[model samples]
Target: AAAPAAPARASGEEIKSPMVGTIYLQANPTSPAFVKVGDMVEVGQTMFIVEAMKTMNPIPATRAGKIVEILVEDAQPVEFGEPLAIIE
Candidate 1:
């Protein structure tokens, strides 16, 4: 018998967070956020930037959809696999 395949992911939705660090909504306190709730996002588009150990990293969207929610606030600390935002 053949081995079973992995289950498929849900359709039309994605939540991407691939690291553990401080998630920032804006590049700086005075700047606007990369994205906001209800904004339409495309694959590879930056959702937000995270700061860890003085280094900044941009988190990109994995799928194209409208942002349903923002899970973190400005300067909020986040962990691995944390839900940064929900898109659908």
Candidate 2:
């Protein structure tokens, strides 16, 4: 008999950056940010966008939760696996 298929895994909390680039807060100067502290977020929602190699990528939320803190600031450079924001 054929083997049974593996069950699907559960989704967990995480921060996902769309691309490898500098992180910008607002679209431009004198503009508000895409996200902020104590903001409620939904799964698959765009928290921010990262620009890498002249390409803009939207960063989405992995799980639904409220933003507890922001680790990075506007116009700050971030690396992979960097904690951009804390969700709870």
Candidate 3:
């Protein structure tokens, strides 16, 4: 199957995975997602976590902005520089 097209980036910023890992959209499975499309996020705010080498690492927004789209699914394996979410 063909890969999904690149998501539109309004501000041209994305929260990328720092290491190869599995992405978690919430603190826990039952908890609400850390963010959703259209939610406003601040700099240093915890957006999501990546489990690498059995460690959960929080990913933060480098700048404050509204979330335009979520590019990753919960528990999905992600690579370094992969777009996790689009913020603008």
Candidate 4:
């Protein structure tokens, strides 16, 4: 069977996962998310944390832009190359 297609956005650059793991949108449960929709981000800004094998890897933004959409929820499991958010 074919995998379901990911939701398509009107326009934006996608920030994809570099590893398969659980994605964290915030530093901790009580903290604000690293980035949210409509937030402007700069190159190299920490966008999300991918926890793999008990290690937390900070994922950085490769391009500077305003966050248009967040594709995954906090603590959600993500696959390698999975789209995490969209920046425009």
Badly placed stretches (over 4 Å) of model 1 are 1-14
Clash number for each model: 0, 0, 0, 0
Report residue 51 deviation for candidate 4 (angstroms). 0.1
Report the C-alpha lDDT of model 2 over 5-79, residue by residue, as the tens digit: 755422334474545688877676787887787889888777777888888777888888988777778777878
Model 2, stretches more than 4 Å misplaced?
Answer: 1-18
- Candidate 3, residue 33: the lDDT equals 96
Candidate 4, pairs of clashing residues? none
**What ordering of candidates by TM-score runs from best to worst?**
4, 3, 1, 2
Best-performing candidate as measured by lDDT: 4
Write the residue-wise lDDT of candidate 3 on 1-88 in tens digits.
Answer: 9999865566658788889999999999899999999999999999999999999999998889999889899999999999898888
Instruction: Choose 1 or 4, whichever is better by lDDT.
Output: 4
**Clashing pairs for predicted structure model 1, backbone only:** none
Which residue pairs in candidate 3 collide? Answer: none
- Each candidate: RMSD to true structure? 5.6, 8.5, 4.0, 3.1
Residue 42, model 4: lDDT of 98
lDDT of each: 0.81, 0.75, 0.90, 0.95
Worst 10 residues of 2 by lDDT: 7-16
Native-to-model Cα distance after best TM-score fit, residue 4 in candidate 4, in Å: 11
Between candidates 2 and 3, the lDDT winner: 3
Number of the predicted model whose TM-score against the real structure is largest: 4
Q: What is the lDDT of residue 80 in candidate 1?
A: 81
Model 3 Cα displacement at 2 (Å)? Answer: 20
User: What TM-score fits each model?
Assistant: 0.80, 0.75, 0.87, 0.90
